[model samples]
Target: MEIIQTCDEMAMACRVAARPLGLVPTMGALHAGHLSLTTQARCDNAILAVSIFVNPTQFGASEDFSSYPRSMERDLALLEEQGADLVFAPPPEEVYPAGFDTWIEPGAVAEGQEGEVRPGHFRGVATVVAKLFTIVRPDRAYFGQKDGQQVAVIRRMARDLNLGVDVVTMPTVREPDGLALSSRNAYLKPHERQAAPVIYRALCAAEQLWRSGEQDAGALRSAALAVLRSELLVESVDYVRVVDAETMVGVDAIGEQAAMVAVAARVGGVRLIDNVVLV
Candidate 1:
């Protein structure tokens, strides 16, 4: 696999590669979840590219930006095994050059939940993703459903900006114990790892209520939060709301449209997020 760090080289590589290309944007620290996207993309497209850049702009002041995991050698090996044609692992200076002030402000889909919890998070995500879309110019971009709100934000941005790329969302890959796969999950200690699966269990509780005809959004949220609160290792709950999948607006009742039971919590100092669709 060709590993290109600079944007210009990556763009040229994409331009020269076969058509019907697919891109999987990631923050590195490759896991099965990330490989799942590439596996699907490889089957769907002739040319598959994966980006591994831990965007500094996405992290807040107290976040683990500097200490985030980086396994470039291992990531490249995995991407090569996944049949990736190009890997754009750009450096911070390359991604955000001197006097880089452009930022893509997202719409209502990015208003609450993570956007509120980590202020300007979606802005950074949108901007960096926009840049990646611009550089890669792939015919389709693959994302996982674990970052449900992020998928919504990127889809909105793509639709509004006329990026002409298909935003394909694959299923969220989970561990045998139901914990959603994430890069930050590496920070979880032994006991923290044991308690981490509670995040998904809480979402399952809300999902059970929705399946049993419990349509009240407040009750669904309460059901999920109660599960999280009952876990002694859970430090705090960020949110557990039932909201429209695309618009990210909380709904009062379940309608015909797609609704998501999403939850985010601080469990053993590691902030984890998970969700399940309740249509």
Candidate 2:
């Protein structure tokens, strides 16, 4: 896999390829989830460009940007195995440069869940994704449902800007015990690892409640919060929202159209998020 760090070189290389492209943007500690996105992109597009940049602007002041996992050697191997045509592992400085000023505002969609916790997070995400889209000019892009809020924000940005790229949302990949596969999962200690699965469990509980003819959003959220509280390691609940998947607006009742029941919590030092469809 060819790894290029500079925007000029990367853009020139993409131009030289002169083929339809697909992109899978990531913050690099490669996992099965990431591999799935890469493989799907390869199957769907003429060429695949996998970007592994750990974006700092997305994180809040106290967040784990500096300590987030990074293993480019392994990341490239995984992408190559998944048939990615190119790997762009740009340095933060290379992407941001000096005196970079503009940002993409996802508006109200960026104000809840992940955004509420990390202000300017979606702006950073939107700006970086817009930059990547400009550089790669991919016909399609892949994102995991694990970051449901992010997918919503990116789709909104694409629509608002008329970027003309298909945004595909893939299912969330999970471990056998049901913890969502994430780069940050590495931070969990031995005991906290066991507690980590609670995020998914709580989501599952909400699903069960929904399936059993309970459609009230507030009640469903309460039930999920109860499940999370069952586990002592859950320090705090950031949000337990039942929102329209496309608009990210809270609904009073789920109805025939399903809504996303999402949550974020502090498990020791790690912040884990998980969601399920309430149908």
Best prediction by lDDT:
1
For candidate 2, write residues 1-279 as lDDT tens digits. Answer: 677888988888888774678899999999999988988988888888989999998988988888889898887777777887888888889889899998888888888888888889999999999999999888899999999999999999999999988999999999999999998899999999999999998899888988898888888898899999999999998889999987888899887775999999989878888887654
Best by TM-score: 1
lDDT of each: 0.93, 0.89
| Residue-wise C-alpha lDDT for candidate 1, range 1-279, written one tens digit per residue | 888989999999998989899999999999999999999999999999999999999999999999999999999999999999999998999999999998999988999999989999999999999999999999999999999999999999999999999999999999999999999899999999999999998899888988898888898888888889888999988888889988999899999999998888999888999899875
Please give each candidate's TM-score: 0.99, 0.97
Lowest lDDT sum, 10 consecutive residues, model 1, at 270-279
**Model 2 per-residue lDDT at 15:** 83
> In model 1, what are the clashing residue pairs, if there are any?
none
Model 2, residue pairs in steric clash: none
Error of 2 at 141 (Å): 0.3
